[model samples]
Target: MAIPKVFITRRLPEKCIKPLQQVAEVKMWSEEYKPVPREVLLQEVQTSHGLLTMLSDRVDETLLAQAPQLKCVANLAVGYDNIDLEACRLHHVIPCNTPDVLTETTADLVFALLMASGRRLIEANDYLKQGKWQEWGPFLMAGADIHHKTIGIVGMGRIGTAVARRAQGFAMNVIYHNRRRNVEAESELGARFCGFESLLETADFVVNLIPYTETTKGLFNQNAFTKMKKTALFINAGRGATVDEDALYQALLEGEIAGAGLDVFSQEPIPKEHPLLTLEQVVALPHIGSASVETRKQMISLCCKNLMRTLAGEKPITPIETSR
Candidate 1:
């Protein structure tokens, strides 16, 4: 019998690959920064038994139809929006994601981004570097205070709950809006569940951690921004498509919101000349919410293990539950 094969979309740490290699013949895209070309991935999937994919890889109906031997798809990140869950279900492929492992790390990044934008840390660094710090003044680089302020978190999932815990430490009042109320979050973290529009109008720091879905796509448009306090500092560490980039730009331009800290964008490696980048008040990061070395290694290990398990006729470690 031929050995089962697993194709990894990107090059990962060799230590994480060794266990999978022992179970299956493993092939990986040589480059870490560049995604595997679509044509190459489609070709590799033809005979592969399992796949370790990145968020950039598209595992749709078309690709699934071509992958006859594919049993499981383990996404490197917690969010599997890049992979079509319905397609995977129809194809009888087990889909897995690296969740819980990176929750705290991502939450840490979300808070850091909030602080950076609220306190204008990046702007302050630029001010000193540009030789504009000739004299210290009361209002020079003055930014928002985070302590004892209202922090309205959208999407009260694991990451959002973790963020609320951090907010508690900072003496911030936490309010949240979710598709359904998170009672545990409310009782344990002292979070107040409020209506979406009310949360928008209330929070001093409006943080978005909602996942991307058809219902949530472009959830933050011009009208949503218009509802926020003009003094509000908007932070999004969630999926980028959740916000209308054009509307966000206009909101900042017109002072509908004070500033923004974005980790994810509508486009990854957002174009240099993107209007959002032009704003001094905006601090944009390249989707590094779970980019810490320790957390990333855990994610890779989980992916490798999930792929290995499914290939060996065992259940995945973190299988995505599907209703369909």
Candidate 2:
């Protein structure tokens, strides 16, 4: 009998690949930075039994239709928006994501970015590096304060709850808006449930942790930004498309909102000339939410294990519900 085959979209650790190798023939795209070309990925799925993909890869209806033998997809990141879950269900393909393992790490990054933007950490460092820190004034690099301020989290999942815990340590008032109320988060974290519009108006720091979905796409348009206080800070650690990029830029430009700290953008590796990058008030990162060393290794391990389990006629470790 021919060994089952698995195609990995990007290079993973040798140790992570070893276990998959024992059960199947493994093929990997050797680059770490470049995404596998769409044509190449389609060609690979023709015969592969399982696929290990990253957020950069698109596993859509068109690709799924061509992959007759493919049984499982283990997405390395916690978000599976890149994959078409409905298509997977129609094709009888199981999709899994590396969640829980990266929640704390991502939450850590959210707080880091919040602090960086609120306190002007990056701007201050650049000022000193440019030899422009000759003298100090009372407000030389002064920025917003995090303590005892209201923080309205847009999503209340594992990562959101973790972020609320961090907000607690800072003594910030935690409020949240979710599709459904999360009682545990309310009781344990002292989070108050509120409507989306209300949250926007009241929160001193408006943080978005919501996942991307059809309903959430372009949710933060001009109207949403206009509703926020001119003194409010906007932070997004969630998917980029959730907020309208153009609207966000205008908000920063017009002082409709104070500033923004964004880890994800509508386009990855945003162009240097992108309007958002030009603003001193905008703190942009390259979507490194779960990028801690230990968390990355754990995500890889979870993804590999999920793929292996699904191929061996067992359930995936963190299967996504296609019914949504």
The residue pairs in collision within model 1 are none
Superposed model 2: Cα runs more than 4 Å off: none
Error of 2 at 151 (Å): 0.6
Q: What lDDT score is found at residue 288 in candidate 2?
A: 92
List TM-score per model, in order: 0.99, 0.98
Worst 10 residues of 2 by lDDT: 11-20
RMSD of each: 0.8, 0.9
Q: State each candidate's clash count.
A: 0, 0
Task: Give one digit per residue, the lDDT tens place, for model 1 in 97-130.
Answer: 9999999999999999999999999999999999
The residue-level lDDT of candidate 2 at 268 comes to 85
Tens digits of per-residue lDDT for model 2 on 1-324? 778999999987888678889999999998988899999999999999999998989999999988999999999998889999889999999999988999999999999989998999999999999999998899999999999999999999999999999999999999999999999999999999999999999999999999999999999999999999999999999999999999999988999999999999988877889999999998999989999889888888888898889988998889998886
